[model samples]
Target: MKMNNVIFIMGVSGCGKTTIGKLLSEELSLPFFDADDFHSVANIKKMSEGKPLNDTDREGWLKIINKLAIDQSLKKGCVIACSALKEHYRFILSTKLETNAKWVYLSGSFEDVYNQISERKNHFMPSELLQSQFEILEVPANAIEVSITNSPLEIIKIIKKQYMKSEFGLFGLGVMGKSLTRNLANNGFKISMFNRHVAGVSENVAVNFKNEHDELSNTLAFDNIEAFVNSLQTPRKIMLMVNAGKVTDYVIEDLLPYLSEGDTLIDGGNSNYKKTKERSAYLKSKNIYFIGTGVSGGEEGALKGPSIMPGGSKETYESIAPFLNAIAAKDKNNLPCCTYIGPDGSGHFVKMVHNGIEYAEMQLLAEVYVILKELGNIPDEIADILESWKASASSYLLEITIDILRKKEGDDWLVNKIMDKAGNKGTGNWTTIATAELGVSSSLIASALFARYTSFYKEERVQLNKLYDKQTQTPKITVAEVFETYQFARIVNHYQGIKLIAEASKAFEWHINLSEMARIWTNGCIIRSTFMEELVEILKETDNILTNSVIVDQTKSLKPSANKVIAQCALAELPIVCMSESVNFFNGLTTADSSANIIQAQRDYFGSHTYQRLDDESGAFYHTEWINE
Candidate 1:
């Protein structure tokens, strides 16, 4: 449900809640309510006589303020000055109204509060009763606590940052979801978490998440979906980190009843773009915003900071940008690695291509390691070479690759003992499918997929290896050449991925900024590298990257080394799928004339599939009668 734009400035007596609340009401153009105005005559008399009001004496007073806050909020929103000193009292005031009320705690030292109260003239809350108020005060964990050291305007600025308190409601306490909740909470945004309980498996996931992260004071966890939904500030932002397909749909359906107009549902899982598009349309019909967001950086990245791509309405993005930017990873310039990608499924589409490039990069690294090993390089030598590469071509994947090579268990290297079979998570295949549909050549990525599929036939390959008895032949190639070839192939793979994104943007009208996309990928993503930072600067200068002089010069300088490496690998009968495919792709992309004209003629001869002659204008179809001639 949508939260009221009400700001509740709360604290004990003499904390300046009324003064600050009045100014805030003016600043926000909202009506102001003071709890003292609703106090009963006997209650005011009791407080004025240096006696603290008991719970019974305060109950009626709180209820009236709560009603006023709710009523005013429903109309034009409001700011309430109330001394909601206890957690239970604040809960009653907040939940009873069913309004997403933001509580801003005007916290101060006891000495400060007493000094302020002593200076006040004809106030019902006496300085003598301050000690009793302090005794009864239970500081709110969920409220935005602003120190009274600052001026009213400064306090308002701090409160404005926390204006969207209870901003994010995350469903599904899986690894990614839990990490994201902690990340947001750590950034001072309040988040409520929920998870569906299974009989034996995930019954205590939410409970464990709450208990483990109790130190994050602004977080709330609930076993019930309704309570989770009720706790969020409106327009409610609920992110679903469940499984990609039907489970995500089910969660959205379950949340639909408790959700109201303007509430947003975010699918943060690796959902198919088609499904995300459909879901976005479906939610829009009901007047709810739907964001198909892609969150990268795995569990560790999620807990710390991740590269976030959010695709939805621009209006919805602006509303949620504060929380997203606060928790996203920062680049060298300390800019957030989060942006509004485009409308509908663009975020998911970009993330899918990212995963595809990740597959190709990993496969290329593996192939290089194999080549180095066959050339008689030890694990330590391989590690040293890769570590050296980090100085020039730094990347998260390369750094980790060096670490993996250097790791040893007892006397054995860990890489030597690992299984050869690789697993697939479907995103790589999705990338290849999308490329095919777009008629873009992503042979490197496709080959990486095929390599994984081939690796899965381990038992059959093992038997065939015994029958064939292949010999290890050292290739006549230096490590420098191999590195150069790797660098070129890596650049080509990224180019292909970016090309796919560009094509999709044109086809879907996403209008995604390639420069911004590159900038966001400079941190917190698997393929994040020094190259991405350089690419971002280049993209800012010119959109026609292939023809850009700087990029073309780099490609030309690297071509000879890449060609030599590929030729040596082929001569040695070593399978270098990604590298070979990359070279072939580059050759085809830059070629002025290809053998496709002959293939077109054959097609025209076999069937009536038309061909366009070189002399003919483009798009003018012609069929040659070869048999009649």
Candidate 2:
């Protein structure tokens, strides 16, 4: 009842704005201001003489009312009666009070409004000019619409009910879902949460979450599908945080029947981009809105703020932008780390590439840990050394690696006690396959994925270790060289991942902005880093990172360090799969005259495949027998 919202009752003249505004004003215990009182004497005189005010005439009056609304919004808030007939007029009145303003549209037929105006006593807006007001009325898409046929008291009740409906609905109660819901509620959004109740497992999950977070008074939880759907306002926005793949499909089918036209559904899981595109089409066929948003930063980020990538209809995106932006992480410049990706599936595709880069980055760091360990550096010493690089090479991966190294179980290093095998959740595999399909090389990401697959052979590795003894010698590499190699390898890894995304964006006609991707990743995602911050600026000039002069100069300086690290690791019988592949990929990519000519000749000799000659600047192909009998 004590809501801090600047409520505006808008409609054509004689639509009961003043009548309901006064009743609601008393109900909410807020000051009521009529727009007529703020109008200039000349404006009232013109209107009284049966002439309507033009846009220019009303501009200053709207500004005066907006100033009053702004001041009241900062205080307890107020109710205002205004004929905000045009969309721009509403926009002018609500400027600087976006989040705190709520609109109630008093809709009525011509006959109803005409009758009310005929009975009016001393209003300056004459009955003859009522038709002019209706002609210029631009109905709002983001307001609570109520019929003026209802009595003023009944109208007040409807307004209150619609105004108090939950602003957003989140339909999953898992770790990430719960965290995000709490984050929304913390940001002053009334949210409804729905988690289906199973017989034994997850029974009353939604209810229990609400009970546990008793401090979040703006949240509601439900186990019934219809009840949950009905709890939201019109054109409801619901985000699903369930598992990707079939489980996501199942949840969509379950909610489809309850969703109305114009309602928006967001898949906030790690769903495949292809699936997201299909879902977008499927939902569009039914007049429902769908957005495939890629949310990163894991559980902690969900509780605080994660980077958000939403792609679907840009129109529908605007309807939910306020809520998404409120809960998204901020970059160095204090901009929200959420943006509209090109269209359906682009957001998920970006997230998939993010995970691919994550795989390579983690592998690169792990290789650094092994090389440092082989160089007789203890866990604590390595942690300190890596922590010292935060000024220039800070990253979420490096920060966590430092924590992981220094974490001890009593007197022993805990990381040593953990299993060597790494697990993947299919995104890296998808990235590798996509690169091959797109004819783009992402060797660093592939090597990282292969390293995880190879680590799964625990028994085979044990037997091989015994059968073929590695006469391993300690590498004569300094910690500084290893750090430099790590930096160079990370640059190559990011380049490869982004190149894959750029290729896909071209192939799919997504028209994605590569620089914006870097900007968003600069803060909340796992791959966020000081390097990503640099990339935000670097990519603005050129989409190809290799073509950028600064990166090229840095690569020139760091290539020798990478080569030295790889050479010593190879001689010492150490495996640096991702780092070594990064250098190899770079070399292959930069080479203009590759040995593929020999490959072409071999293919032609065996399969009679024709070859193009280097001298053939003209468009021509040639074939000749090397051995003439």
Candidate 2 stretches with Cα past 4 Å from truth are 1-3, 11-16, 39-64, 82-98, 106-141, 147-154, 601-613, 617-629
lDDT of 2 by residue, 1-629 (tens): 23367999999999989989999999999999998899999999999899999999999999999999988887899999998988789889988785677888999999999998899898888899988898998877677889999988899998888777887899998999999999998877789999998899879888888888865666888999899999998778999999999999999899989988988899999989989999999999999999999999999999889999998877778777878888999998888899988787998999988999999999999999999999998999999999999988999999999999999999999998998889998889988888898898888888999999999998999899989985677998888899889989998988888888898888888888989989999988899999999999888887789888889899989999999999999999999999899888888989999999999999989888989988879969888797789
**Taking the candidates one at a time, how many backbone clashes does each contain?**
2, 0
After TM-score superposition, the amount by which residue 302's alpha carbon in candidate 2 deviates from its true location, in angstroms, is 0.5
Candidate 1, residue 303: CA error in Å?
1.1
For each candidate, what is the lDDT?
0.85, 0.90
Q: Please tell me which predicted candidate would have the highest lDDT against the true structure.
A: 2
Using TM-score, give the best candidate's number.
Answer: 2
Model 1 TM-score, 2 decimals: 0.76
Quote the lDDT for 573 in model 2: 92
Q: Least accurate stretch of 10 residues (summed lDDT) in model 1?
A: 94-103
Quality of model 2 by C-alpha lDDT: 0.90
Q: After superposition, how far is residue 244 of candidate 2 from its true place, in Å?
A: 0.2
The window of 10 residues in a row where model 2 has the poorest summed lDDT is: 1-10
Across 116-233, the per-residue lDDT of candidate 1 in tens digits comes to 8889997888788888889989876445678888898998887775564466888987889889888887765668889987778778677777777665555777888888888776
lDDT of 1 at 517: 91
